[model samples]
Target: MVTSKVKQIHDFGQSIWLDFIDRKIIFSGELKKLIEEDGLRGVTSNPAIFEKAISSSSDYDEDIAQLSKSDKTNEEIFFSIAVEDIKLACDLLAPVYNEEGVVGADGYVSLEVSPFLALDTQATIKQARELWRQVGKENVMIKIPGTESGLIAFETAISEGINVNVTLLFSLDRYKAVAEAYISGLEKRAADGLPVDHISSVASFFLSRIDILVDPFLDQKGLGDLRGQVAIASAKTAYQIYKRMFSTDRWKKLAEKGAVPQRLLWASTSSKDPAFKDTRYIEALIGPDTVNTIPMETLQAFRDHGDPASRLEEDIDGAAGILERIKVAGIDMDAVATQLEEEGIDKFSKPFQQLLDAIERQK
Candidate 1:
């Protein structure tokens, strides 16, 4: 039986995707069980995730050893292994992907491009296309950071008919740019007489990281009450943006031609502060046309005690007010967002390099 709490999120039009992926879960049938019993809608993997999965377990040793014998570089070997896992996962979720024949509805897995190419538009575009071809699955979304350069790659990828997951979004302005890019991509496709219905994308707005960064500043400014609130407030405001952006006449034309709006995906959702409840992000952000990709621990926590509700649209003005107060507190949000983007790029790049180094040792 599906755990009513986790499964119940679907009733509010929200989908829960697991934030972690590895060979153990895929091979042990754990991923399948999550889909069947917990209503898992998708899977998302990052360089850090692959680093942990490959380094911490012997599950990938055989593939590594086999690929090593072919004189492939460590990075090449890594993608080969990662692609195989993504392909297997896509197969497992094929039912959900095919559910009702709605292309952008549910059942999507995300594989991120090299974070090293985050600042290089052309390189990122090349790699995204290559990864898309390598995975060779309709349900797979190639993850690209929402850097300014990444926006170009994202738009180019979508125009070429590849699915995208725009990660590392922290600013409302950048989020608007991402949505504009998505629309532009679809418009280009439609103008070129290509199929727009098959193109799918998600703008992933990170959650806990926002509060984690702003809380210390809040404490320094003696505004401690707002410690854990900024992220949710930001997310609620983003939803309002989603509503406005998609309701425009421009979006309606694409919709008539079968272009689905790129849904907002909530990433980095696990609570960073121990004082907060385990499912703090999940319970509060449940609403239509959104996804919350959570870690396994958070998933278990939510399944046990989650109280589902349509709370995302609640407190619209209150959400705006929290953001205003944070601004008035003199914490430069745009600068904070800029810092987080740089740090986020570094965070992924280091692990990606470490993962490659580990693979080199194996080779």
Candidate 2:
């Protein structure tokens, strides 16, 4: 039986996705059991995740040894391993992906592109296309950042029918740009008479990281009470944007032609503050047509004691007031988001290199 907490999330029309993944879970049938018993609907992986799985595990040694024998560079070997694991993951989730349901519902895995090319539109597009082809799974979503360049790369990638997961988005403005790219891509596909039925994408509005970045500023400014609250306020505001964007006449036209609205996926949901509830991000953001990707720590916490609720819509006025109050308090949210996004790119890119270096030493 699906655990009531997780099942209640599904029953409320939101999907729960596991934020952690490795070959062990896939091969040991743990991923399958999560799907069966916990209502796990999708999987998301990044360079940091791959780094941890590759560096810390004896599980990947034999495969890495075999892969290292090839003439490919360590980076190439890393992707070869990642693609295979993603293929396995996609197959594991095929039942959910194939179910006839909503236009944009997903049972999928996300594979991120090299973050080093985040600012280079053409390069990002080329690599994303290559990753998409290499993974060769219809259920695979090529992950890209929501940089100025990444937005264009996204539309281009989607125009080519490659699903995209737009990561590292922080501001409402950036989120709107991502939604625009998604709709423009689908519109181009429809204009060319191409099928738009299966193209899936998500604007990943990260949660905990925002609070991590903003909370210090709040404390420094003597607004300590607002410490753990900025991220949720930002997220709820973004969810409102998601609703408005998908309800526009333009989105309606795409929907009529079978295009699915790109859902707002809440990423980085684990609370960084010990004072905050472990499931603070997940429980607060629950809503229809949204996804909350929870790391194992947060997921287990939520499963143990989460009280699910329709709270995304509950504090609309209060959320608006919080953001406006934040602005009046002299913390520049746009600046914080900018710093976090730049750091986020490095945060992902560095691990990938470290993972490769670890593999090189083992080889």
Candidate 3:
């Protein structure tokens, strides 16, 4: 039998995780097929994904109606439905998590905290803990945005042994800050003699959105050749940063205490420009100790015709020059990242409210 193309990505040391989750896929054995046949090792969900799934499908209607009749609020009802899905998914992927294989390392399922609380550190912390308790699964990763406030919440969550997926990150500077927070969390745990082995986290560095913002600036600046390039360049630079930080004595000390280096996960990876290859981000960003979470269409495109290789570290100098040229062309990367973070939060927050309202209408 010919091996599916997605499984070949594993040979290069990068994981291809599904950037979606829904009740039908979980119960219909679709998720199982992907896990066993297509080499899908993980799942990621957010308010946007859940909103589209819950609002568009009858799969969740009965649960919504039953929860609506109870005293639970719309938000509670939504969580009740979401947590059950996550619980079931976690159980199905338990072996992948325990196998602890180097490539298909963690069988994680990500559930985001409320996007409304993106800036409210304390509320993010409280809700994350509560959600973790509700799900009650060893393999579930509570996703928090990599906002300024979220850095604190991440360290706190990881210090408490809760696995976190720090989402919505965009800039190299901010990615550094996230790595710092992860290290700080592990150090704190080790300082307290806490068992740091089970704690896991991933810094989700967004890919395609960088070009969505920066490419236009380049085109307007008469740098047509530079169009559709910023995202991969920035991600390559982020990987270099990952290597530098995780190789340090600080990380080594934590590793001695059983802490896993928080891996770099590439998020928002689908190629937005129809003119570009569908799997550009996935192919360009492949490397060891990292993940690329992709939506279904992009995942299928890769399996159909993707060429996987270890290209992430191939052009260290060239990647640096690309960012430098962006700077020379007057592109403000910090501003772009900041704007994307705010928009990313709103993107999820709006749909989340819509999801709650949709669930309420089921009554």
Q: Is candidate 2 or candidate 3 better by TM-score?
A: 3
Worst lDDT run of 10 residues, candidate 2, spans 99-108
Model 1 lDDT tens row, 214-250: 9999999988988899989999999999999999999
lDDT of 3 by residue, 1-363 (tens): 888889889888888889999988989999999999888889999999999999889998888878888999889899899999999898888877888344226799999999989999999999999999999988999999999999999999999999999999999999999999999988898889899888888899998888888888898988889888888889999999999999998889988877788899999989989989999999998999898899999999999999988999988999999999888988899999999998899899999999988886787
Better of 1 and 2 by TM-score: 1
Give the Cα RMSD of candidate 1: 1.0
Clashes of 3: 0
Better of 2 and 3 by lDDT: 3
Give the per-residue Cα lDDT of candidate 2 at 348: 95
lDDT at residue 119 of model 1 (Cα atoms): 94
Candidate 3 local distance difference test against the native: 0.90
Greater-lDDT candidate between 1 and 3: 1
Stretch of 10 with least lDDT, candidate 3: 96-105
What digit string (tens of lDDT, one per residue) describes model 2 on residues 1-363?
Answer: 445687689888788989888988988999998898888999999999999998988988998899878898888888888899999999999898988765248797999988778999999999998999998888899999999999999999999999999999989889999999999999999999999988999999998889988988898888888888888898889888888999999899988988888999999998887888888898888999888888888878888999888788877988998899889999999999999899999999899889989999989
Candidate 3 residues lying further than 4 Å off, grouped into runs, are 100-104
Report the number of clashing residue pairs per model: 0, 0, 0
Model number with the top lDDT: 1
